[model samples]
Target: MDLYIYNKALALQNVMDTYGSLRWVRRYTECGEFELHCPFTVDNIRLLAQDNIIRKKDSDEVGFIEYRNVKRDETDRENLIVKGKLGEGYLNRRIVWGREILNTTYELALRTLVDKNCINPTDTTRIINTLILGDIGNFTGNINFQVSYQNLLKVVEALCLEAELGNRIRFDKTLKKLKFEIFQGLDRTSSQTVNPQCIFSKEFDNILDQEYTDSIMDYRNVALVGGIGEDADRRLLTVGSGTGLERFEAFNDQKGISNMVDNVEMAEAEYSALLSSKGNETLAETKKVQTFENGVNLNSNLRYKVDFDLGDIVTCMSKKWGITIDSRINEIEEVYEESGKEVNIVFGKEMPRTIAQKIKLL
Candidate 1:
């Protein structure tokens, strides 16, 4: 035999709130329950299916299912805790239960002032503006403000059409091309310098001209280091292993050296200020700031605010309440010897009576 339990009162309230009508089902269970013994009809099965609450199989059962008292489930308890923590769950649920209360009362009043002259709910633009700006108070004057599903669909379609037509024109034909004559020359010179047998130098009569080639190559390398052309090579040259000019060029291109020089100057100024102070306190403070800025980029909101006091409080609370509950359950298992019990009590019984109860008290 199959058994099912549902909150009839909540189900009725949901139906009434959605359709604004009471639907009576003859074969289904009610709020306060009773025992029964008979097979239900296909029409009764169809009614349950319509609400998406139950399913029926082609089983030839001989006995009717007993009606049980309606009660809230675990999802309801979890939702209660979530609402309580956020301070909005209770009011939202109250609104669901037909209690008319406005959370953003002041904002609604401001909306009423702005929407004094324009109060057309059926207008797609007006409906969209209200939702985007959260101005529901202006909708009070319009009887159709309580939007039907069909009206929402219409509003979505209108917005989508507007977005689709926004990018109709393209202007690639009128765009200007960047000049690259200087960069192209630099690339040619650098290629010839690296490989003396390149086609450009091969055509020259005095191809053994290392002096002329070296001068042009030096200029090309400098321009390349300054981000001039596509073929500008950026290979590093060691100081002791090469000529002074070559080593200087390589050292200049090494990344982050300029930033490090600036940081060093700033640190020196800060250290001087600290020395002028009575004690090492100011110096320590300045060092801390320098260390933080140098080691961390503090641009992302997540990374910047990660070490805040409020975040620590939330983390501590989560560990204590969320994780500690399981710890306490394990402790209970250690204390309470299950072997002595007469009845074959399952894990479900221990969960609700022991662990869940302890968690609530905590």
Candidate 2:
């Protein structure tokens, strides 16, 4: 990918003609952000201080600048964090500012992402309809969502989780649209397989590096979810268990509700889902592979010729590790630089629980 700088009017300012990279990461269950780093120059510094924008472009994707960092004596170049145009609405929301969305369906929540005027009274950006996908289903739920001072990206992620769906955004060059795809369970179906011989090890030219990680924090067998209704005195509790005492996690959702019984029922169902989702303790692996092949580029879009994508289940046999990794593509990081371009892929079923989701409600 190539990085370019643009002015407020969206005119080209500078092309990243120097040595650097346009870095980006995509997450299956969360939002993804972009970054650019190149040789620092006085003009770039001035642009950073002004209304200048940084963008990344390739055969398939595009990114818009959101924040910039300059490294003078400390480093060699300037760096910028870019957000895909599709993400502008979500990233702009304040974490502390919360909004209450009530009586809405899954499709409407998604519409809020593209239809700025529908969700935010002040947003003016045009909605891109071609990029939207998936059905919102028939059930409508009330969200006591606090504009929460949390940015819209995270807030919307939580909303999707509550609805038992997966959310992701990607740039589709064929359609020339920033595609936002939502799935009911896993993101994609696995039709590809990676054998031990295909993996880069001390033997393979395509494999550059690989790392494996395992954690118990992701394993939760017993989940206790509690909530309170409109009346402070009214309380509800639900417990979902998978195994005996391996670990116990509790969630106190204080999102206001009028009915305690209904809220508790919802909490129980959510707890059961959460328990089933996170009930795993296994070795997770991340792989980094070379982008060059016989002087041809392969690690970008063509790399997926093996057929793998975010939330897709794939079988990976690593002889060196003596274990087979069969899981979802939770996250992927792509790096482009003058030295060479490489693709970093991470595999896992679910992310570790965050403190925000575990917030205790009074």
The most accurate candidate by lDDT is 2
lDDT of 2 by residue, 131-209 (tens): 4443444445433322324455665565654554456544444453444556643333223333311232223333434
Q: Candidate 1 residues 160-183, lDDT tens each? A: 121111000011112211110000
Residue 111 shift from truth in candidate 2, angstroms: 2.9
lDDT of each: 0.18, 0.44
Q: Which stretches of candidate 1 lie over 4 Å from their true place?
A: 1-84, 96-106, 109-144, 147-362
- Could you tell me which 10 consecutive residues in candidate 1 have the lowest summed lDDT? 79-88
What TM-score fits each model? 0.11, 0.59
